[model samples]
Target: MEKVFKVLIFTDLDGSLLHRDTFKFDEIKDYLKLLISKGIFIIPCTSKTEREILEFNHELGLNLPFICENGAAISGLELLNIDLPKELILSREKDDLLNIFKNKVPINLQNKCKWVFEMDKKKQSLVFGLEDKKLKMALNRKYTIPFIFEGTKNDRNELSRIIKKDNLYLQEGGRVINLTDRVSKAKALRIFVRFFKKNNKNVKTIAVGDNYNDLDMLKTTDFPCLVFNDKFTLDEIPIDNLITTNKPSPEGWADVIKMALVKIDKN
Candidate 1:
């Protein structure tokens, strides 16, 4: 007997799903609802903070896990899971890391640039601050980090250097370096997949994103959807199972999902 497969859609928010500036995408709501009706899981994976994701979850009425802070944290409902896997704290002593950040590149923030920075305060992860236009602009830039990290190779090297040997994985997201001694997007997703495999009647995994930062999760899934646009520098790697949206941002994302599901049905 062949088992039916279910689908999991891990969508990136910034350039992948929403419009660059305004985070409004209504055209895709119906498609999302249709997927939900068919028992498909839609997970919004992003470099956004928990608070940022919460707002989206609220608006979309989605209760699935969200990848926030560049996979540094994966949360659902009331339970918050950190990739670090350590005793969660506000901040930690990262004199070496801090020094590297200071010397390599200026934080590139301005007075007007607002942000809710998540940093280690006493070995715990903490989030604080208001939004700033400067920070917003920095996040919108191609690379959010100090060094020239633009691809999987560059990112892998930098991750090895900046983090302690014990703390291997790191996420350079939005405008912050999510440093963790523990897990990664791909790893966390494996866990999520296990849960789905056991609970769901059928399961499928779909990953969507538009930047270098999304490389891990995109590679992890069976389907990697690239939200094509001019701003993002995507990999030229040949992955046969990819869904390139017809339109960038809201419209494109909507079209890709609906169209992919249609194609899935056809085949």
Candidate 2:
């Protein structure tokens, strides 16, 4: 008899599973539930804060573990009674990262970027399209600082050099550019995949995303999917099992997942 394989899925929330502009997953909610019912684990690997991802999990009624703040930290595994290594947390402390940004980047160039936290409630809402409560949740980040760069190409290059000199990095997501220490979605995904494989040796990993930040994670999985995003194109990836969705957001998410489920059933 053929051995049955356990499937684990890692997904980027914004611009992949949820509508990029509205941030709603209603279109694929039922399908997501169906995947969960079939014992397929869906892990949200995103740049969202813990609070925001937790809220999303609560809304979806999924108790799965999640990677947050661009792989700065992983949480919710305690519910599964799984003990993860402390070193799995890859980013530096939030305050330290912010301080590095302030001290490294020149004040003149810094003036061109708007730090999300320093903005007032209304301005924050205007920039992020979130209301007061949601904006508050987004601000509760522990490891990464999101900002909008309002400078020219040369200014951005200068800022990048300044940040690199301080041992920090920048990740461009669908909405904002994040400043973080040495942490990435790929690093966190590897940790989780190893943990999962220890229990189920036949586990196959699937990863889906829509932006540059998702590149590493997508490349790390057995099955890689790139969801369509009108605002940005994916960087060149050299994976053979890669798939691209024709539509965007919840529609594209549902399509790819359904296809994966069918292929798994066949196997």
TM-score of 1: 0.66
lDDT by candidate, in order shown: 0.58, 0.84
Candidate 2 structure quality by residue, lDDT tens digits, 81-129:
4565433577789899888788877789989888888888888888778
Q: Which stretches of candidate 2 lie over 4 Å from their true place?
A: 80-88, 235-238, 264-267
Alpha carbon deviation, residue 88, candidate 2 (Å): 4.7
> Residue-wise lDDT of candidate 1 within 1-267, one digit each (tens)?
555777778888877787755667777777777878887777787766566666677778776567655554555622222332222222223344444544543243222112223223321121212245423432332112222233466545654575444443455554334444354566656666665555455666778877767777888987778887676665576657778865778888876776667766654
Every model: Cα RMSD to truth: 8.2, 2.1
- Model 2 TM-score, 2 decimals: 0.92
In model 1, the Cα lDDT at residue 85 comes to 29
How far off is residue 118 in model 2, in Å?
Answer: 1.2
TM-score list, all predictions: 0.66, 0.92
